[model samples]
Target: MNKMVKGRIYTLIGAIGWGLSGACGQYLMNDSAVSPIYLTALRMIIAGVFLTILAFFKQPEQFKTLISTPKEMFQILYFGIFGLMLCQLTYLIAIHDSNAGTATVLQYTCPILIVIYVSLKEKTAPTVMEFAAIFFALVGTFVIATHGNPFNLSLTPAGLFWGIISAFTYALYTLLPGKLIYRWGSLIVTGLGLLSGGILFYIGSASWQYTIQWKPYTFIAFIGIIGIGTIFAYTLYLEGVSLIGPVQGSLLASAEPISSVFFSIILLGEVFQGIDIVGIVLILIAVYLITMKEQLQEKHMRIKH
Candidate 1:
């Protein structure tokens, strides 16, 4: 198989892993006694340990170098707490408040936030397509939130709030790691970030004080979230991105929400309102458009060089 083909497979599967993680969260919430915050801390610690150990073996030099530098250590720690930790926790909270399908789709707003941030930072206007994307994204968000009813809001307030915040954090997660990931690789950076986030959140939230219900199926879901979801998902996705580039990898990553929705419909017996489907389509289009912009820029850079 071609390397690019392998990358696509890896990316698709990785994204699906993420989507499944959301469904697992919803299941655990419905079936078990653990809180979202507690789950987040546990996931961070377990996944962090596994990933860091992998990093020490696979990327020992890079890992050692990253840890030795104070500035890099600070940046990775901040990225862990603010980026990965917050993003995961908020998305889970959104799942708890709404459903996995809704939360996953809502988080797609990250691209719009990223476009706006970059435009502002560069002091340049977004392309016509970008403006269209922004319009689509906002409209999609509104449609989902209100079920297209202008008169009343349909979704729970907590769901909407956490979903939106998750988008912002997702954007931050995307933007903050470029330098660190490029220098030390995703394995080291993300491993350290996960551990840092786990430690900080563990101490701050006192998640250790809570008792978790350890059932058979619940244990399966927990392992699914940490093993197949966090560790494998992050590793495979990052590896795919390195091989195929971020633009293609990101486009492929749209699979996450699709799988989330599918899992919700099939496993949870959740029904999607027609308006919700329309809104999801629009949000997906918005993401597609933004990706087109990145594709064009990459092409332009290649041709110029």
Candidate 2:
């Protein structure tokens, strides 16, 4: 098989693994009575260890460089707590408050948030495509929150609130570590970032105070979250993105939400109204629009230079 095709396959499977993670998290929250905050802490710690191990073996030099750099400690620390930790916590909270399908789709709105953020930082207005993405994201979120009626409230307040927070934090997750990832590489940086967040969450949140049943299914779900969903997903997606580049990778990464919806419906027996599906499609449209706009901007820059 061609390398690019293999990369695509890896990325697709990795994305599907993330979808399974959300379903497994929902299952545990419903069946095993796990606390969302504790689960997030455990996930960050375990997945952080696993990814760090992979990074040590796969990119020893990068891992070494990351640990040796004392100046960037603050940035990495911030990325962990505010970016990864909060993002994960809010996402799980959203899932617990609503469902995997809704949480995942809402979280997909991060691209629009990123666009808006860039516009603000640059002191410029959004271009036509960016404006369209914002419109789609807003309308889509409104559809989900209100079922297309201004007065009718369909999703819970907590669900919508956490989902929106997750989007913003996820955008922060993407934006915060740009320089770190570029310098030290994503595997090591993200591995270290996860470790930082996990340490803070474990101590600050007192995650040890929470108790959970250790059944076979509990281990299964945990392995799904820590092993497949996070470590493998990050590793494969990074490798695939390295091969195919960010433009195609971003487009392919959209599979994460689609797979989440699929697993939610098929495994978790979650149902979505027609309007919910419409909202999901609209959000996806915004994603594609933003992706194309990014590609165009990059192309223009290259030509100008």
Candidate 3:
């Protein structure tokens, strides 16, 4: 297959993997006695270890360079803690409080947050398309939370709060590590960042005190969360980005919530009403519009050059 085809396939696989992880997370939280904090810590630690080992073998030079610079080390540590750790914790919390589909769709609002942030930072008004995206995102969020009723919220307050927080942290996670990824490559930066963040979570949560029940289903969920969800999804998505560029990769990753919704219905028996489906469609359309605009701009620039 050509690079483009491979990139698309990788991106789709990565998205599906993430969607499956969220579904598995919801199942584990509902079925098992595992605390979200403990599950988050364990998943991070195992995925971090796996990614670190992979990085060591695949890019030893980058791994060596990653630890050599004190400044970058601090940045990585910060990224790991604030970016990766917080993102995962809040996301899992959302899943625990709400269904996987709701959490996943709400988290997709990150692009709108990114638009607002960039516009503020650049001291410029958002363009028309951006305004449209923001509007759709807001309306979509309201619909999802309220289930078509303006006054009645379908999602719990805790779920809504954590879901929005997860979106913000996810934006930070994407933005904060640009320099490190450029300098050390995505694999190295991501591996070390995961390790650092996982360590921080473990320390803060005192996860060792939690007595884990080792049932077969629990073990399977752990594998899904750590192995397929974190390590494989991250790795494949980064590889896809390397091949197809961020705009296209992100566009492809819109598949995640769709897969999340599908899996949630089948696995968790989460009922999606008409309003909820409309909310999902609007959010996805907003994302598609924004990403498509970026892709078009890139094409225009290439044509101009």
Give the top-scoring candidate (lDDT). Answer: 1
Q: Write the per-residue lDDT of candidate 1 for residues 154-195, one digit (tens) a residue.
A: 889999998998899898888888898888888888888999
The window of 10 residues in a row where model 2 has the poorest summed lDDT is 61-70
Which 10-residue window in model 3 sums to the lowest lDDT?
Answer: 210-219
lDDT of each: 0.90, 0.88, 0.89
Candidate 1 TM-score to native: 0.97
Q: How badly does each model clash, as a count of residue pairs?
A: 0, 0, 0
How would you encode candidate 2's per-residue C-alpha lDDT over 118-224 as one tens digit per residue?
Answer: 89999999999999999999999999899989997799999899999899989988988999888878888788889888989899998889888766698888888
Per-prediction TM-score to the true structure, in the order listed: 0.97, 0.96, 0.97
Looking at model 1, residue 133 earns an lDDT score of: 97
Residue 91, candidate 3: C-alpha displacement in angstroms: 0.4
Q: How far is candidate 2 from the true structure (C-alpha RMSD, Å)?
A: 1.4
* lDDT by residue for model 3 (146-207), tens: 98787888999999999999999899988899888888888877888888888888998898
